[model samples]
Target: MTESGTLYVVATPIGNLGDITQRAISTLQLVDAIAAEDTRHTVGLLRHLGISKPLLAVHEHNEQQSAQGLIKRLQAGESIALVTDAGTPAVSDPGALVVQGVRQAGLAVVPIPGVSAVITALSAAGIVQPGFYFEGFLPASGSQRRKRLEILKTLPTTLVFYEAPHRIVECVTDLAAVLGGHRQLTLARELTKTFETIHTCGLAEAVAWLQADPNQQRGEFVLLVHADVQEKAEGLDDETLRILQRLLQELPLKQAVALATDITGQKKNELYEAALAFKAANTHE
Candidate 1:
């Protein structure tokens, strides 16, 4: 009876080869076998590092068969490593099925975190929204993608999605319609590459910016949009802060807070505190 072996879930660089971590490099070199999403794509990475090993294709199409062979290799006392074409495997990539199979076969799955597009985009976006949701990439066709957006419409946090250049315009339009035109958005393209560009504006303005740039129609992009700003509030009060900001021009702090709270459904104490702070700051200036 052979005891099962360990499977390393290693994360590769999204674009830059320098992004590979020391641990990931060491693991890939030390593993008995590496199951790659694309052996041809991974060959370049291996050659760059001067490390050579057996490569197996384990993408969505062949994951089942690949997992069986990999499990047998593990049972034979071989350590295996999994690498996607880019970034971390199983993150909108193709290592999930193999990982799930490894677990079912009673093998250990250890993650080797390094570079990822999702993390890279989020960090450089300069968006300090309370939190954000990563919805990955939407479906390429049919009502499936629209259905996803309908659910995305209700989230109160920032929305982030990965998109291809060809579909970028359609994605922006759909997002604007579902999330509203006034929603603040940032479109980051070719991240970490030589021609990286970040465009920040409302939904409509983002679409316009894309149109203005004839060359921006190429490369991958990460789309981020504010989910909080809305014209009409469902349960919470609408325009409380804006009303308070407006009334401060005419009324005193106390009066403005009272009026704003009355007009909107916001809590009186919260509105009063915010109003007081706003008034104090303005008065000081």
Candidate 2:
């Protein structure tokens, strides 16, 4: 019986061809064939590297079906390299199903990691928060996106999101509305490309900044929302605290805070802080 071949999950440059890693190039050259998110896009990268291999179209539309075929190839002792149009595969991108399927079949799946848009943006963001929540792309629906943001609003860690150029203006508007205009936001646009721009400002100012220059709204964006630090809850009276805690038991933290604000006429930020404290106290017990 022939030994099963390895499946390499390689990360390519997000932009700037020079960013491609030596190991990634070597793996691509060595693989029997490559499974690409977009064959037309991957062909350019492969051509640039002077590597030739059979290209298979394994995209979101046919990932599950493609996975089975890939497994059969690996079983036939044909090594394969999986790559997305840019950055790593299976991360806010296709190839996840293929990787999962290959693994379940007991085939070896190796990672040749390199450039990632998320890590690249966060590296230069200058955010002091110790950790981050990578929310990736939010729902395209405005109402659904806002609902998700509401739940994430009070998080004490940095929030990382990916946004498309066309929806950037509207996305920023919703962000300011739900996450608060006062919070700091870092916009990393067209990363690693010729027109790359990284700017930081308050959420309220993000929309204006993007609109003032049309070019600014023309590329992929990585938005970094600064962490929310809970303020002192000393101003809350016993009645308000009681009300907030009671609401917390039956509602999400953001909802609890909002209802408490209406009931006690306390500031929303203050009520949010109190709600976090109450939840933390309960968690430790």
Candidate 3:
């Protein structure tokens, strides 16, 4: 039996075609076939690179079905390169299922790292937070999105998210409401493109800024929210801190803070803030 061939998870340029890596180019040249999230889109990239190969559709709609066929090809000793419309594959994009299938089949899967919107934005975001949670794209529905943000609001680390141009205004508005208007938000749009823009301001002001200039809402977006900086429990008495911590272990943050507030006569908001700091410190440990 012939040995299975490798699958290359190639990372393509998010915007500037010039960002394409030389190694990625060489891999594309050598792969037996290229599996793309969007054939039409990948074809354009291939055309620009002056390389040609058999293109197969492996987009979000048909990823699972396509993955089976890809595995068959690998088993038949045919190498395949996986790519998305832009940026790294399988990262808030299609191609993850294909990679998972190939791995389950015991075929070699390699990464051809290149430009990523998240990293590209972070490189210029100037955020000093020690870590960040990449919450790619939020729910499209306003209610669902708000609930997600509420859950994430208390996280002490930076929160990163991607938003579409049309939903940018609404998304920011929700961020301001759920996460708080005072939080700093860095908006990175159209990275590596001619109309690229990176602006940072309070979440409350983001909607106004985007609305004032229609052009700002155009293109892709990467939003980085500053880390939550609530005060620790140092100001509270030892007994209050102890009660809050114990309650947190047994209840949801809201319920725990509420109960702690009632029991200790401490302010609810203060207890909530202290709870967040406690969770953040424990999360790392």
Best by lDDT: 3
Candidate 3 Cα outliers beyond 4 Å, as residue runs: 1-4, 232-285
What does candidate 1 score on TM? 0.79
Models sorted by lDDT, best on top: 3, 2, 1
Predicted candidate 2 versus true structure: per-residue lDDT over 1-285, tens digit per residue: 112388999999999999999999888888899999999999999999999999999999999999999999999999999999989999999988999999999999999999999999988877655788999999999999999999999787789999999899999999989987645688999999999999876677789999999999998999998774333477776567667766776788988888888888999988887776655433210
Worst 10 residues of 3 by lDDT: 276-285
Candidate 2 wrongly placed segments (more than 4 Å) = 1-4, 230-285
lDDT tens digits by residue: candidate 3, 38-62: 9999999999999999999998899
Please identify which of the two predictions, 2 or 3, would achieve the higher lDDT against the true structure: 3
- TM-score for candidate 2, residues paired by index: 0.81
Residue 165 lDDT (model 2) = 92
lDDT against the true structure, each candidate: 0.78, 0.85, 0.86
TM-score of each: 0.79, 0.81, 0.81
For model 1, residues 196-263, the per-residue Cα lDDT tens digits are 88766657567788889878978988888755444233333434555666677678777887888788
lDDT of 1 at 172: 85
